[model samples]
Target: MKKSLIAVNSVAGAALLTLVAGAAILLVLMFSTDGDADADRRAFFGSLMFSTKEQADGSTAITAGVDDPVPLIVLFVVLAIALTFIQLTYRALKVHRQRLLEERGLA
Candidate 1:
């Protein structure tokens, strides 16, 4: 059971890392003005949550169709904090367990 839990956590961590990396890539690409209109459109509007476009009068327009990204951002921040806490707790527990085993000559 413990091994399965660890495996699941590893997969989840990998998935989270992949998602963060993808988001970072998209953000970088979104700002890259490569002189390609279609590519720029795709990159800028990649996310379904919200989109921002430049207007003709040098102003930006934000179009969020009922899906606000603030809550999603907050959720991601909280999840990151919780994941850090969980990892720290797991490491501490592992060290304590090893210490206990060594003290009892079981390791």
Candidate 2:
């Protein structure tokens, strides 16, 4: 039961990683600029990175990151969870390796 649960989790994690990668690729492609014709469409995607718009007073209003922010927030949440599991896996392997070495009186 425990083994099956682990197997399922591993598969789920892999699927999620693939999903995230696809999402990232889609975001990039959406932001891609072909030429000057895409300048208008690039506003939103550009804002995800950076932008500087001139104000009425001849001052520049600089901004960065997504204005909606939901996408960015969701992306961070997914990455954080993936990182947590990665760290847990690394620690577990290290501990298991140390335990095995100690068992054989090698450490």
Candidate 3:
């Protein structure tokens, strides 16, 4: 039973890691730009809510219009912590069960 629980926990942790990594990759891809002229200008103004000058390289480098990734970062951190806690709890439970079995001379 203890060995089974450890195996289950390991599988669950792997699944959780895969999910987190997929989400992170999706987020990164969504925020990536295509360098389209009109689209970039629209994104810049929409994000900044103001007009801005073009850069020396003929590109509009809007300082005020960066996408905030704080929420995503926080979500990932929470998920990782939760996964760690779950794995730890699973291992602890497995150990407790083994100890109980040993005490009863059942294993």
Best by TM-score: 2
lDDT of each: 0.56, 0.57, 0.54
Tell me the TM-score of model 2. Answer: 0.47
True-vs-predicted CA distance for residue 90, candidate 3, Å: 0.4
Lowest summed lDDT across 10 adjacent residues in model 1 is found at 36-45
lDDT of 3 by residue, 4-106 (tens): 6655665566567645655555444345544443233223212222234466788865433335444444545666567666777877999999999999999
Model with the higher TM-score, candidate 1 or 2? 2
Of 2 and 3, the candidate ranking higher by TM-score: 2
Give Cα distance to truth, residue 8, candidate 1, Å.
17
Q: What overall lDDT, based on C-alpha atoms, would model 1 receive against the true structure? A: 0.56
Residue 90, model 3: lDDT of 77
**Candidate 2 or 3, higher lDDT?**
2
Local error of candidate 1 at 10, Å? 11
Ranking by lDDT: 2, 1, 3
TM-scores, each model vs. reference = 0.42, 0.47, 0.42
Could you give candidate 2's per-residue lDDT for residues 4-105 as a string of tens digits?
Answer: 565566556655764565456446645564432312232323325434456678765644444455554465566656755775687699999999999999
For residue 10, what is the lDDT in candidate 3?
A: 57
